[model samples]
Each structure stands twice: as C-alpha cells, then as structure tokens.
Target: MQINCTVIIQAFNFLITYLFLRKFFFHPTVQLIKQKDTAKKILAEKLKLKELAVSNLVAKKNSDLDAFRYSISQRYQKPEQAVIQIEPNVLSKQEVIVSPEVIEECKNSILKGVHNAL
Candidate 1:
C-alpha cells in the first residue's frame, strides 16, 4: 500500500493539537477537580469532629445539672426534716389558764377603748 502525504500531515496535526490541549487545559482542570475533592474530604472530617465535641459537651452539662439538682434537693430536705422533727415538740406544750379577775380587767379595758374611738 502506498502512503499518502495528506494523511501523514493530518495525523501529525491531530497529535500536536491533542498534546497542546492536554497540557494547557485538560491537566489543569483535572488537577483542580482533585483539589476540590480533597478539600471536601477534609471539611467532612472536621464536621464529624465538631459534632463529636458538641455531643460530649452536652453530656457533661447534663451530668453537671443532675448533680446540682441533687445537691439542691439535699439542701432543702435537711431544713424540712429539722422542721418536721421540731413541730411536734412545739405543739405539745401546755396551755395556760387565765384568772377570772384578769379576764374581767381586759374586757373592761377593751370596752373603754371602743367608747373612746366612738
């Protein structure tokens, strides 16, 4: 088979064009795409770490709140228990009986105050 000059020239032109496009355009675009992918992976890892930190913080706060509530309940309960223990003793004290003469004197004083107000 005889080779044509036009076919060789066209093939050479295609090879040169392909090499130039790959060097200037295709390679840079591929590199940019790879960089973006790496950045996305790094961001995802950072997000997972942040979520884990938030969960740990929430757990610590919950435990602290529970401890504070327990301490407050104990503080209130001690006074309530003391008051309950002292209430019976206070109620068991004897009643005093007033003399008839003293009762009559108080009634007379009250009546005098009412008359003066009128």
Candidate 2:
C-alpha cells in the first residue's frame, strides 16, 4: 500500500513540472513567432506601395514624351519637293550633248567582245 502511494506522488510531480515548463517557454515562443509574422507583412505592404508609385510615375513620363513627339511631327510636316517643277528651257545653254565619238567607242567594245567568242 505504501509503494502505491509513492508511485502516485511521483506521477503528480511529473505533471506539475511539465505544465510549468510549457507556461514559461512555449507561450513566449508562440508570441515571438506571431510578432515576426506581423513585421514581415508590414514590410511587404510598404514595398508594394513603393513599386506602384514608381510605375505610375513612369507611365506619366512616357505619356508626356509621346505628346511632345506628336506635336513636333505635326509642326514640321510638309509636302515633298516634287510638288513644283522647273521651266522646260532651264539651263538650255549649259546642257552638254554626247558626241558621235562616244557612240563609236561603245560600238567598238561590242565588236571586240564578239571577236573573242568566235
């Protein structure tokens, strides 16, 4: 009977020790993990906001550049120079005519080629 009482006392002591360790260590470990999660969430939100602002700024700058390009093209656009023609008699005195000697030279070249083939 005495040995049964001793065993029950030992079991009760072990239960109390287990409960104390859980209260002192496990509870704080859980709280620290929760704090770390919240910090990560806040940091992610801030980075997302910064990225969105940069994207909006780039879009606005590109739009401005496009508008400037359109305005410049419209201002300088004009018809081609071919819209006007010169008079038929322009530089009538200065025009050089090819002589019959040039035509004879071309004829001699063709004759020489025919001679080589035969």
Candidate 3:
C-alpha cells in the first residue's frame, strides 16, 4: 500500500478548519441563539404578568363603580334613577315619559331639519 503525502496534508487541513470554525463561529452562533430564546421567554412572562395586573385593575374599577351606583340609589331612594342616562333615546329600553321641554326641543329640531336630537 502506497501512502500519499497530499492525502495526509488534506486531512490535516480539514481538521484545522473544523476546529477553527467550531471555536470562533459555530459556538458563538449557538450561544447567541440560546440567548435570544431566553430573552423571548423572559418577555413573554413579563407580558403575562402585566396582563394579569391590568385585569385586576379593571375588576377593581368595576367594583368601585357598582358601589358608587348602589350608594347613589340609596341616597336618592330610587334604584332606577342611579343608572346612567343614555344619550340616544332609541337605545334605552326603559320608557322615559317625554317632558314638555324635551317635546318642544324635539319639535324645534324636527322643524329645523336636524335629525340628531331625536
């Protein structure tokens, strides 16, 4: 069997190139990918925490509003009066008896060709 000098040189060159790439390029790239994944996980956890905090704040606000409404109803001795009045009359299910002032305003708006006051 004849041993070629070029074959040994080629094998040595391949090994050196592989080591250099592993040390300087491949290892750093792998570490950077791992760091990016860690960052994404940290951001996701923080976002979840923020979402929970916002939900808690909303729930607190709703409870406070309900308490205020209840207090208003007790003070007025009328539960229905405590409800916030809707601007658009058509959307409100409760039938409000038209006051003479409101009827006059509606009649004036209709005569003026203004459709929004109804």
Q: Please tell me which predicted candidate would have the highest lDDT against the true structure.
A: 3
Give the per-residue lDDT digits (tens) of candidate 2, residues 1-118: 2568878889999999889878998888999999999999999999999999999999999999999999989997864443233346733688656679967975886676556544
Candidate 3, superposed: residue stretches over 4 Å from native: 79-118
The full ranking of all candidates by lDDT, starting with the best, is 3, 1, 2
**Estimated TM-score for each candidate:** 0.64, 0.57, 0.62
Clashing pairs in 1: none
TM-score between candidate 2 and the true structure: 0.57
Q: Which candidate is the best by TM-score?
A: 1
lDDT of 1 by residue, 5-110 (tens): 9999999999999999999999999999999999999999999999999999999999999999999998776422221122246334587467899789868866
lDDT of 3: 0.85
Q: Candidate 1 — worst ten consecutive residues by lDDT sum? A: 79-88
Per-residue lDDT of 1-118 in model 3, one digit per residue for the tens? Answer: 9999999999999999999999999999999999999999999999999999999999999999999999988887732333334457663787888899989986885665543332
Q: lDDT at 37 for candidate 1?
A: 100
Candidate 2 global lDDT? 0.81
Which of the two, 1 or 2, has more TM-score? 1
For each candidate in turn, give its C-alpha RMSD to the true structure in angstroms: 11.5, 13.4, 15.6
